[model samples]
Target: MQVFVFDWTAYSENVDKFRENGKMIRLGKKHFNAKTAVDTYKNHAEAWQELERYGFDGVAINEHHGTPFGLGNSPNLMAAALSQLTERIKILVYANLLPIHEPLRLAEEIAMLDCMTGGRFICGVGRGAPREYKIFNVPMSESRGRFNEAFEVMRRAWTEDSFSFDGEFYKFDDVSIWPRPVQEPYPPIWVPLTGSKESIEWAAAHDAAITPGVFPGPMREDTIRYFAECQARYGRKVDPNKISIMVDCYVADSKEQAVDEYGSHLMYLFNTLLRYDQVWQEDVKKKGYYSSTAFEHLRNGAKGTLAEDDTVFNEWSMDTVRAAAENMPLGTADEIVERIIAECDDAGANNVLLVCNRGDIPHDMYLNQIRRIGEEVLPRLQAHNVTFVPHAQFEQAAS
Candidate 1:
């Protein structure tokens, strides 16, 4: 049982408000505009270092947007910073958009980071955000195909010693990448999907992993069943223990305090992400997939409502968010830890990723959340044998 904290860095500064009137909680920094390198660097600095010092086996980051909100688009830079900041802790980058970049370049960057970290890197690649593809002017029709090609290209760039590739998307006369990654055969690749059975089957066939985030939702049972079925279809036995999930969490010294500080943020998360059928229209639904439904249900359920319409409702009140946050796991450290432990226990989770700041939380408060999780939650988790063995397993093999 590994407990990995995750933060979406969602800036609450995005949209205005809804009918319910609660601000639409965001998952990425409000980068509809642009952010100066100086400003972004100054903000995420402490959070990065604290994760390294904390009890986490590894520190993780994902490329969300470009420049501002999804600014970590170039994770090698982020990894480089992490290399200088911490002595240990695996640097897990959910990945450089495999489809959008030159595979050889990605390979080189990954290898360079691995060497810099003394081989402490776990790389995961995706087709880049579908929305981002539009922003980057990438052809969405070819996103999946391009991703598969780049995935192979990046690997060959690291492993083939010397090779050539002439694929539909990537064409290289010499598939040679300088400075190979330290991990043999390359780091593990986990495909993040929205409970797509095809995805599970594909991952199983390649011995890859999937983070179906739709886990632990209202359709939780169905989601698990689908994954199991996919594993079987792939003829590769998958230990439920190997599957991981992403759940929103928060903690405090007292339940009241937890509610006070985390209430609005939590509610905002549900409504924005799980907007109860609000985004189920074919267009909005097609954008992200059925998992969009998951958000709708989760948000609706949390607010004790039924999502019967598809009017793309955004109406919410701050009061609603405040109340939802109150009932959630926000509580004293002891109480919060208890809840986290219970989640891991029930799910038999091997790894846990925590999404820390969803709303535009004050930077200081975000750092405090990390520190609290590290000091109070981590020790008890390990003592109770709850956290899994490796949030990251990027240590260099014994020579």
Candidate 2:
């Protein structure tokens, strides 16, 4: 079984006494008054190194925003840092938001990282959240279209010596990019998901890896069912290694303590995170993302928040917030393993990615969970062969 580790590297200095003020917490090294990401990097450096030490085959990173909610919107830059810190473990940026920046430069940056990492890079891309689009002055509606084109352009820019393209969103003539990606044809493209039908279909057509957030909750089952249904309807068979499910995890001696301790962080995720769901703003439409199937306008980013509807957040609505938090298993190692395995089987998923330190899980809790997972749960999962293998490190045995 292949296993991957995911961390938002959530920042905060308090270390104890949970509180978020109904806003995104300033939880990272940089945002929580730490001098820089390098400082926050120190906190996780050992943990990530531990993931590698404990036999996780791949390590994944993601972007988030707002003080206490997220400070790292440039996960790719950090991915480069990880390449130096980790060895043998596959490195992935669960995504680099495509529409927010120039695709060509992004492509080159990824390519450069690939070469530097000796081809250990697993490139994930996406149209990203509407709030981000609003923040960057990019239209939400146009993001998907631009995303599709930008992906194509990146592929070309990475593989071909010279290429050009003309699309509604991006146009380039005489496009010659240097430092082609080390992985022949291109590195694996992990399609970060937002649980949209359109997004699923796109991943299927391209045979890209799919990674979606399954915030611990009652909705976990629904999240699994939806994705499995989409893949099946489209005749897409996701190789377990290529498909991943994300979990906001914190391990505790008992479930109640887990919930009580982690509740505040969960609240922040629910409230502040809701703000990002909206597909608000006239610019998003003007850019060709004019119509969106996304459950947009669930929060405040002020591009014209859409009235709440059932279609967007689905089972993850306001009422279910408590249930969702309740669903995240914060118990003994065995219990967590059982819950994770059951959830994976029910949802037809095999990969379990835990974003540690999220919700400000305590350092001791983090250490215990990591070791427990490594010492107990992981071997069992491997024995069952029920999950993706954390990319294994191989060396030539003496012949």
lDDT of 1 by residue, 1-399 (tens): 566666444543433343234444432444343454455555776687777778676666787653223446667788898788878777778757776787888888888888889878878776554556656777655666777788778877878889898989888896567788788888767666553344445566666656654444434433344455545655544453465566666767776676678766654555554352222334533444223333332323312112223222344466765565554556677776676666655454556677677655667888888898888877776565533312111111110
Question: Candidate 2: what lDDT?
Answer: 0.63
Span of 10 residues, lowest total lDDT, candidate 2:
390-399
Q: How far does residue 145 in candidate 2 sit from its true spot (Å)?
A: 1.7
The 0-to-1 C-alpha lDDT of every candidate, in the order given, reads 0.60, 0.63
For model 1 the TM-score comes to 0.77
lDDT tens digits by residue: candidate 2, 28-113: 44334545445566767677788888987678887765444454678877878778887777888878888887899999999888
